[model samples]
Target: MAADDLPDEVPADPALSASADPAPSIELLAGPLEIVDRITIASNATFVGRIGETEVVYKPIMGEQPLWDFPDGDLGHREAAAYLVSEAFGWDIVPRTWLRDGPLGVGMVQLWQDVDPAQDAVDIKPVAAVPGEGWRLVFEGYDDRDRPVALVHEDSAELRRMAVFDVVVNNADRKGGHILEMPGGHRHGIDHGLTFHEDHKLRTVLWGWAGEPLLPDELARIEAVRQDLDAALGETLTAYITVTELVALADRCEHLLQSAAFPHPRGRTPATPYPLF
Candidate 1:
């Protein structure tokens, strides 16, 4: 792609945000950024930095680990695009993310969420110890100790919306580590690099509602996306994704509206990611 074909380097102005609230963090991201430390938990090279008084996470395009499955572009663009998709939902599923030039190079910078240490949104428990309520079981399996365990996540509206968001984006990886549990009971989905595939690659742990009908509110939100795919949303997406991908996104939105339910895993049959942390 030519440099002229590239998307705008920054996000839309704060005045035009879906939240309808002004935020200075977006400006800080495009301005001076100072790295404080490297985050060793992620597969790619990640860093925590300060933009004025705001804290953010930075993932440089150069640090992306190339995969045979995702060859079209680097992960940074996907991160920005994911933010755009989440913004379209107006669900606040994703954090404030945008692309900008950093110390190393151009990368994705996102506002950091302060997590509540006592909370565990997604967790594994001994099979017998799994709670009877407040959680939905994904599957039952054995642990490293060969003891029976159950993989479960909170059964809440927040997680359900995130599950729907994952479906629309064709997210290939929605590991336990990517779900951030914030203080006010709001959960934000992170690490969206492996998303928006043209094919069905929705690998996530929040499939407890598989094959179930979407609620009226859920359907309304999806319809809005489907209706706007050919308008502003589609135009903004073209900056990051290909024409093929944009079409696929529209198809996914239509499919969900037609099916009106959470889709079951297709080819692989419950295609879950490896090292399921």
Candidate 2:
């Protein structure tokens, strides 16, 4: 729980700052579909589009539930934070998001990614009722001219390395369903609300590398982040997270740099955190 296990706070770059207009334009997949107003986001929120186009996941904003001690139905702030970090890290993961006014008033707009079509459909039956339930795995390939190969496999070495990345971020949710298998062997991660915790509550299903060693490049990245902790990037995270939480994030980076091997987290295995959608 010390303030030394997190990534440095990354600041927003002038070139990638949030848009000036708080409310952007809204559109529907079907022509002239009614834009339902003030809809609430509950468990029943359903996805209405494919990955390539706009996928609308509807949920009521009014609620008082708590997941991981964080307020429920606050997808807006979570979406914003995810966008900021995803952009800063230059990660190919996660969908691009923008704040906008929608049927539920002001909300977030995100790009939808499709499920991989190569691997056989994952049987979501096994982990359906776990604590943070409801997960499904995507396939590995799809036919097309522009698509590339999938980078990481669920049980591959690259994915094991990704598990380490998740640990450093204290990702509480990393269930099988959260990891996406794209058309080309590209693997992407989604839903990053529980990261940057004040306490080092690192939990994730990508624990395939729990006791492994970091690659030279990975270690280098960790060290570089340590130097940037108190700089621009760290400063940006402070805007969304508390100062203490920011410190905790930096602490994680430092700890990772000091250790030759990955450290085990204290708790039961962590599942993938749920996305607002």
Candidate 3:
């Protein structure tokens, strides 16, 4: 779809905005749920629903279609693990995601985020040559009518932080649509089911910072995550993924700390996903 044709931004549900503590929101996620809409384009069965008064996205395991590259029926757990990593770093990139038993069966439920319609930070088309400022050219391609096109994205601090997080998690599918821009300029990332694989698989659109030195704060966050891995992150992820994957996660942290630079594509697979958006 053209960027201009994107759906209107859904306003944040009032129920979640009422409290800052988040305990009430957690309760709502666990409370009785009712489906309000089904999202048909997703590879798996996904729906938008209300839990009590809060809005959320639910992805049931029973709805998953098997992928030869990923283990079957475990995408929901991976989504939750992504949230856990985001929480550990205090990045708040991924939405509040958790595992629960839904009407369809066990699944992952995440708080629905309302994006800012005015901003096109995640996905935008340039009218001419790539903008000289605040954007990075990802690749050049052809549109449907055989026209030359350049794919680029925002070069903002929030997106840079998310790029760091993606490297740590080995996120295999960081599509353009996965990045959400909230009303107050905050960005939230979602759709993390294709992440945390034991092997390296960090395909993404936020390669603007690739090869750049890590900022001091970014380096500090990496160290903090490394320190907490064995105690908190390790324990939390084991329930969802294998121990080997957990070790791989720690190794990724250490490698990034040593390198202190945004990584270039490994070339083992396509650096970017099939559908850039």
Q: In model 1, where is the ten-residue run with the lowest total lDDT?
A: 1-10
lDDT (C-alpha, whole model) for all candidates: 0.83, 0.49, 0.81
Q: List, in order, the clash count of every candidate structure.
A: 0, 33, 0
**Every candidate's CA RMSD:** 3.2, 11.5, 8.2
Question: Candidate 3 — which residues are off by over 4 angstroms?
Answer: 1-20, 23-25, 124-129
What's the lDDT for candidate 2? 0.49
Compare the candidates by lDDT and give the number of the best one: 1
Worst 10 residues of 3 by lDDT: 6-15
lDDT of 3 at 13: 21
- Candidate 1 vs candidate 3: the lDDT winner is 1
- TM-score against truth, every candidate: 0.92, 0.63, 0.89
lDDT, candidate 1, equals: 0.83
TM-score of 1: 0.92
Which candidate gets the maximum TM-score versus the true structure?
Answer: 1
lDDT of 1 by residue, 71-165 (tens): 75468878888888888888999998877667777778888889998999888999999987889999999988999999999999999999999
lDDT of 2 by residue, 1-277 (tens): 1112112332222222344222222223211222333324333232332222345433323322455555545544454455555444444455565433334343334545677766421222222222222222332333255443221224554455456556556666655566667776666666565565666566555543455688786776666655665786666555455677667767887778778567765655433333311
